[model samples]
Target: MSPASTAAASAGPSARRQASGPAFALTAGVIGLCLAASAVPSPLYRLYAVRWHLPTSTVTLIYATYCLGVLASLLVFGRVSDTWGRRPVVMTGLSGLLVAMGLFGFASGAAWLFAARAVQGLATGIAISASGAALLELRQGRDPATASLANVVASALGVGAGGLLGAVLLQFAPAPLVTPFVVLAVLVAVLLLGMTTVPETVPRVSRSGLRIATPGVPRQIRAPFVVAGLAITCAWSIIGIYLGLAGTLAPALLHTASPLAAGLAILALGGASAVPPLVARALPPAVQIVWGTLALIGGIASMAWSLSADSAVLFVAASVVIGIGVGFAMFGALRTVGAAAPPDGRARVMAAFYIVAYAAISLPAVAAGFVAQRLGAEATFQIFGAGIVAVSVGTLLPALARHRAQHRAQHRA
Candidate 1:
């Protein structure tokens, strides 16, 4: 065989072995950056509010618009990669992100902020599904457990890092409002270029003559999907509600609006959460699930107390604990969801999972906003805490049942 043919013939098996390394690295990088971009605009919102002489409520509106764009785009094209291939879809998503980042330079008023956020949302919506699908497709091992765990942790880390980094960059960096986006834009451009070399996992297939129907998730996987959805939703909801406005809320409660301090609170949430995934690397997914949920319950409860007592230190500490809970539980569930699903149905199942996850992101924040307006930041957080506890319990029951059943079966075998 010629050299090219020899390479082609050998690529399939070898590629699988090499799969987790590159795919994990790439997905982590891309998703982490995407999360950072989501939060980069957060601290800057205050800057825009002040510079444009805008109300805080207006800032919330701008943020909401971004979520709207994300939700809409996901509904439309979230499953596109299932038929069109991963590379094209991901590249397109990156392009949208690049455009959104560039729009930051010109954002001088509410309209400009709105436009930038909307574009950013669209960019994220595109990238999320494509990148997630790519991660699943790239798994090369006989067992996909490790790769799936990596995917969830990487995504959590990315989100946590982005918020913390955005906070740090805005506070300590020179141009609080302008610099972060610019840096992100440059990095995104480089990533976009790098994505060109990423191997496509999904191949193109004809969409025509197919009976247009919503793809049903496989029956065998539904229970696992629920378990996965619960873990992800609970964790991400905390992130969205807290990180979304912690910069603004922390100062009000603390009697100081120091951007540096507020940003650090957000950073603590990210930093503290990052430790568990690394430590739990060797743990069984079941143990991780239970302990992680307990941590989240504890964290959420502590943060609620912080809010009620008006203590920034307590709030920060609570956030860290919760973030750890988030990392362990969310990653465990995501791994299970991916592992249980068949390969061909992966993208659609994942997309459905995201629909649940993003709903967790969007709806709670909206409720928090309303609560903030009607009661106050403190009251809103207390309500959020109550919701978290309920959700966690609801999710944990099923997971525990499944975990126990699996162990029993193993023992019987």
Candidate 2:
């Protein structure tokens, strides 16, 4: 055998096996819980509006506040996970979630809502980067497919459960608004305590006297970055509309109007999104991207049809379609970027990708809410759905043409 192959073989299966045990599960749990708390309030926006007599547009603004917090935190400390180690930064993020939840449980006005969302955003921003990096590091030398699958599944479950658990808490608990956050805060504290059990995946002092700065992309990788960024943004924009506004829009659109039911619309997407990666193990990134685009087209079309026809069933179906698209696109983008990214520029490239993603979720949805107020809600939704479809289709056609052209050139040669 070659020296490199021989060395790899000599590394021992036992050591590779060690990384996948209890410690990894503990780490995944902590990260998943952190993400869950970030979305727990998604279902509660209606309660806040009812309690405060605020407008739906106001709720979108409140949701937008969370994005702002996430953006600020990412800008300031997105690389902290790389520099300071993932565990400590994650623990800090969880603590932020705990504090945010406490504030939200007791929130009475717009200011409190804004503060809670900001805290949640900051907490999520910190946890997401650290958790993802840590999961990758911990799974090094193991099955890359398994590691990616775990992260994607955990993210889906966490987001889905956030809405369902919050909705159930609101539907059944006494003082629903106050109770869910209190429960989530306590759960976060438990996760926080559990953090001590997991070993740090990223070691301290790796900087070796280097000054850590904002993340960047290498010149050769820029093309992939642009395609990955656009695909990612388009994919996540579907989610932005679902989780950010579905709570308010679903009731009116589907005529259910119950906050709990509306929460299910978002939950449906999250739940359905989680299932695909399990079956699609080891899919190539490019293939996953194509599937994602197609799914987005189908999902958005279904949603538009649902709105036009006033069928809740179709709305639910649309959620599933979109969820599948998100699952494929997100994982595809992650794998593509991670592979294409040179070590030196990985962080910056990832930072830019996330900025686009969160923008997809926050900006367009906020715009939809205002448009709904003026143009009528159904018309506004159609516009949102149509616009997303166009973007997804627009993104897909050029890529497909390029892929075919490349294939033809290769065959001709």
Candidate 3:
């Protein structure tokens, strides 16, 4: 056979991997597993601090380290799967995570944790990038919006489940820190195995596309991408604050400091995140953005007052509102990006989107940790709340003004 004929013959199989109906859910499960595994350390951060005599700033650094690893991986390996094939990259990343679990389980001090988390983050970034793009390709006959919704819902539930799983193990297991990741490892293994059954989604990969580079946005989507980036940056900043402080807030205001109690806020918030996407299944992205931003601003305001007044009910209520807002806002924004993303460049765009998302989640929380140490959690949270409101209003107002002007012009026509 001619070289051209040989290449064409081989290309047929490498080009497309027809997915079963279950592959869609399974792909989303991979994203969920990545998210859940990342949180396995959250409930244990307190344990690490107490056992190691580490300061709050250092604990926050450990958390930030993971985000840093994720960012670095996204920048470098984000597009590797585009050339390397999603199946191999996903499997490789999962193996890295499995090793990270071992590191976390055997860690002797702060340094081990930093190493473990960094490994965990890098692995997660690659896995999430591959799976996210896989979701787009695996949609089969489904709309891109459905795939986006699945991604949001899985992330929400996975985070809640991870925190709760960690806390439960901590509260009941004989050895807290060691037990959580061991259990998590088993879950990761199962998911890793399940992935083998899912067919590869990438069309064809070549050695030339293997170079390390930053994930890039296509110029066509850059405008909507910025608007989407603003939406998530605003929403996730508030989430980062909540995640950083919820443990302390539970004890200070609610008077419950147990490991189980500490995880409740995250669990509740994460659970609430899944609700909006389900309810707003048919809601337009624009409407979702407006309603979601409004909910976030109101929720944060209510939460700030709840803290000052020591009203646990109000705080819980606000958490629900904020969580729903996260669901809607993130879903709306990501859905917009997904729709705009070119099929071939989907993974790169998604990786760029995550870079923005993780930075928003990481930077603000670290800043809040420092502020809270100096000002106290309640006061720090109030300041945090105000900042979210400011960003939300700044984001919401211009969109609203432009929307109104567009509507009037349409009516005049």
On lDDT, the leading prediction is 3
In the range 291-351, model 2's lDDT, one tens digit per residue, is: 8888988988888888788887888888889989888877766766665643333344556
Q: What does candidate 1's lDDT look like per residue over 147-193, in tens digits?
A: 56556666666665666566677768887777787888898998888
The better-scoring model by lDDT among 2 and 3 is: 3
After TM-score superposition, what is the CA distance of residue 183 in candidate 3 from its true location, in Å?
A: 0.9
Residue 66 displacement in candidate 2 (angstroms) = 0.6
The 0-to-1 C-alpha lDDT of every candidate, in the order given, reads 0.72, 0.72, 0.81
TM-score of each: 0.89, 0.88, 0.91
Clashes of 2: 3
What TM-score quantifies how close candidate 2 is to the native fold? Answer: 0.88
Lowest lDDT sum, 10 consecutive residues, model 2, at 1-10
What clash count does candidate 1 reach? 0
**Would you list the rank order by lDDT, best first?**
3, 2, 1
Question: Could you tell which candidate, 1 or 3, scores higher by TM-score?
Answer: 3
Candidate 1 residue pairs in clash (backbone atoms < 3 Å)? none
lDDT of 3 by residue, 1-413 (tens): 11333323222332223433666777788888888887667778888899999999999888889989999999998888777777788888898999999999999999999999899999999889888877766653335577788899999988888878888898899888898888888988998888887777665543245556679998877877877888898878887888788878875667777877657878888899999898887876756777788999889988988988899888889988999988988988877777777766667888899999899988888889899889988888898788888888777764565356656887999
Worst 10 residues of 1 by lDDT: 1-10
- Evaluated at residue 338, the lDDT of candidate 1 is 65
Q: Model 3: which ten-residue window has the lowest total lDDT? A: 1-10
